[model samples]
Target: MTKLSLNRRHLLKAAAIGSVALASPAYLRRAHASGGEVNIWTYNNFVPESFKKQFEADTGIKVNVRLVDDQGKQFNLLAAEQPNPTVDIMTVAGHRFLQFIDSDLLAPLDTGRLKNWGNINPTFSESDWSTIKGNKWGAPILSGMEVLSYNTDYVSAEEARTWDTLFSEKYANQTAYIIQDMMSIIMLKMGYDGNMVAYLDKPEEAARIVEEAKQFLIKHKPLVRKYYDGGAEIQQMFVNQDIVLGHSWNGPAAALINDGFPLDMTIPKEGSYGFVYTYNIAKNAPNADNAYIFLDAILSSPEIGAAMTKASGYISTYKDASNHLTDLEKKSTSFTDEELASLQFFRAEANKMKYGLIDPAVEAIKAA
Candidate 1:
């Protein structure tokens, strides 16, 4: 029973801040039949230790968690295991979850086994992101938007609500952007002068538009204090007052405030990137029955959702989790369900491909 700490520095580093590795531990190459224990693989700092203990206490099934360094590695691990895999459940993001489903690496979830399946917000439960062709692949457990986060002492709510604040000369050499998720930066660049909607509406121009966003980033490089890949690095910059505004995911921003920093995250006028984290059952799960038990445990109780949010700094997907959040936690993440679903964002596949090009462009510009 390794107790993993959910600290800012540790979580960001292990979150695979940018990409995934092609290989995983060799021990997981083959599948085995159900044993007394259930093996789960996921990113670190997501589920709290207490929750794992409680789940065991309730079901009497010992849980073994394997930490994944990157979200990309989840698929790589699955692809390596092939027909039979030892992992029972994995935490896959919506985009990667789709790929898992397409590859037949995921099993159709039996909603009848999930007591709280009916309680999930209909918006997520009914969406194609979690369900496809009458089969549900996973349960949406965490949700959040990559919002514009800033130090309140330096930038007020009014000034920080727009994308302009990031590129303004007032904060020249004092702004930072997470280069890891280049897609979000591309969207920020496209919306800089209000050209995002027009650009996205034309998919054929994705390459050209992305190039233009790279050039835009280069143009504002002078204003940027530095480019970062990990959320914790950006959080450290804020704590040291090295940056006033930058690109940040909601969880890390929330973590900052909880640590006593005056940080705030908001959806910019152009909109922010929204994502859903899912718990997927491996197609060749060793303990399929326990997988269902875990999913039901998370969704059926607000306490579980609250614990997840408190540990990961992201908002809960469970509808009833709102009853458990503190006033401060609620204020840190102010996005509504409509806003999360309505944000003009790119799909994970598209975003991943765009970043392939956007990454080198950023490097070249930074060198220049």
Candidate 2:
């Protein structure tokens, strides 16, 4: 297991934080073919190790987690393997949820059985991601937002608030932004925000908007140290002083800040980009019955939901969970009503064809 997959801190915390008083399962739900091991596919960094163990202890089933090396690659792989899916539980971003439904790759989710179903926040739990194909591809647990993160030892929040600071000569070689999922976000500065209801629905128009973002970023590149895909690498760079300011997610930034490293999650003037890492069940999964158990454990149990977010970086979308998180999780976790109100997430489906498909425009921006 990778460092990310094996995280035990949150589970240790969950046990202490959550009142584990529920009656033990009266009887394991009758499995379709008898419950066995469940397979989970997601990136290594975010899956909490504690979640897997506690869940296993409760249900007497094993979770075989597969690491998804790249987001884009994983999406295509699932789309192609629709009929003969391998993994049982998939933790994917919301935008990708729409794609999964489009490909007819999933089974309808029955959240009614989940114990934690009532704990999830309405914003994250709503039927938004439950698509037209009738399969609710993902059940969102946490919402993540990206903002300009800066090392407070060197830069000030006020200084990093505007886009101009990145373009300024002073911060040159000291700034960075994300590449894969933030084109529409940057376009917000150009007055072309991601109203997926409008922009994502029109690919050509989204492409034009992306072009403008490229123009801004290409010039901003000289001032930037690098472009990033969300991971430990960005935080490593910040800690080492390789870059002073970055476009990064809430968890890492907050983690660094709470660890006493000089870090700040700067909310830029134009707003921020957002996404939710949600739980989905794979069709033809090897252990889907167990998968359902795992999903319910997370969605319905406030204790599990809260502890899951405490361990993982993203904010838990469950509204009813008890929070036993560290001060950092309390401060930065995005799932709460207060945090949601403060956030400005981008719309899904709108810029998807243009940004979601990795068309020429997105590649051009990356290559540039």
Candidate 3:
């Protein structure tokens, strides 16, 4: 598997850029683009610079991107700037798409205009997260799955491909919880049968389920060597040999293996948790025409999708894009049919309630 090369300069550039201070001139200038531009608010480096240039060349519309780390902040900025909003295009995780839809922040999509919409993986296009309330508010653009990632030098592929390994005595104190969010671990403890999002549809039942999920984490606390608050720490721990097996997203796992860390991710037999970042046109975008044109050009073209995947570790939502990716890129970003059957994603609105309930529950568990 060939790994996409990452240079020190790129890493530094990514780390140095943070969210433009809210309401600053830079933020204001970017939030509102001229008629000739399509203002976009997305994660740093989520869109490939090369693709943006190509889109600009094909069409007269100039692409303006603003980097932000927090998806919640996207809504905050939009809400503050409403009635005369600046951002024309917004990209958010699939799980959080509903929040914007519920708040009336997104424009109803005309999928017929997106020529390559059909090329997107059915798993994404058909997902409730992609199409809510009978309207498509966002297009799934990037993907990453929460799979069992471990240092291969320490754990064999067979041993790492099961949820049971996380609780086993063999790797006890050698396992780590790298993800800050507890939803993945909570879902695993729930046996992957209960829908975390179901809490929204059936609150009474979900409330009880939430309690059980928290207790499950407390029970497994002894098995964890450390509970990391971020991905970088988790990667550092794995590199230092502090942990043999831990939970990880596919993108980071791919980067680690490529860095020669002897690490890899496995879709556990018990299943996996994954997420997709979707592209949505703002409800009051100034250049809605250009936004659709840009979306179609980027999301519909396999080559363009491949460029984004290559530039960022995240996978493309369009499945045909896999044809343009190398073996390692496919292995890192794309999942097989069997893996897809086992993967589950949460509903953003329902998950908001879950996060609210789980946060304090986790605190109490850790305190105990």
Pairs that collide, model 1: 251-313
Q: Global CA lDDT of candidate 3, please?
A: 0.70
- Looking at candidate 2, the ten consecutive residues that score lowest on lDDT are 1-10
- Better structure of 1 and 3 per TM-score: 1
lDDT of 2: 0.64
TM-score top scorer: 2
Candidate 1 lDDT, 1-368, residue by residue in tens = 11223455644443322112222112222323223667889755565676666556555678889977456567888889978898999988775565677788989888888878876776777786666768887888887667888888878888876778888999898888765454454555465312234445456576676677667777777888898865567777777778888888788788777655777777766676677878888987988887876677667666667667766678787777767767876676567564455364335444445545565776777786
The order of the candidates by TM-score, greatest first, is 2, 1, 3
For each candidate in the order shown, give its overall lDDT on alpha carbons: 0.69, 0.64, 0.70
Q: TM-score, each model? A: 0.77, 0.82, 0.76
Error of 3 at 13 (Å): 10
Model 3, span 13-63: residue lDDT tens: 442231111111222234333248899998655677666664565555788
Candidate 3, after superposition: displacement of residue 164 in Å?
4.2
User: RMSD in angstroms, candidate 2?
Assistant: 5.2
Q: Report per-prediction Cα RMSD to one decimal.
A: 8.4, 5.2, 7.1
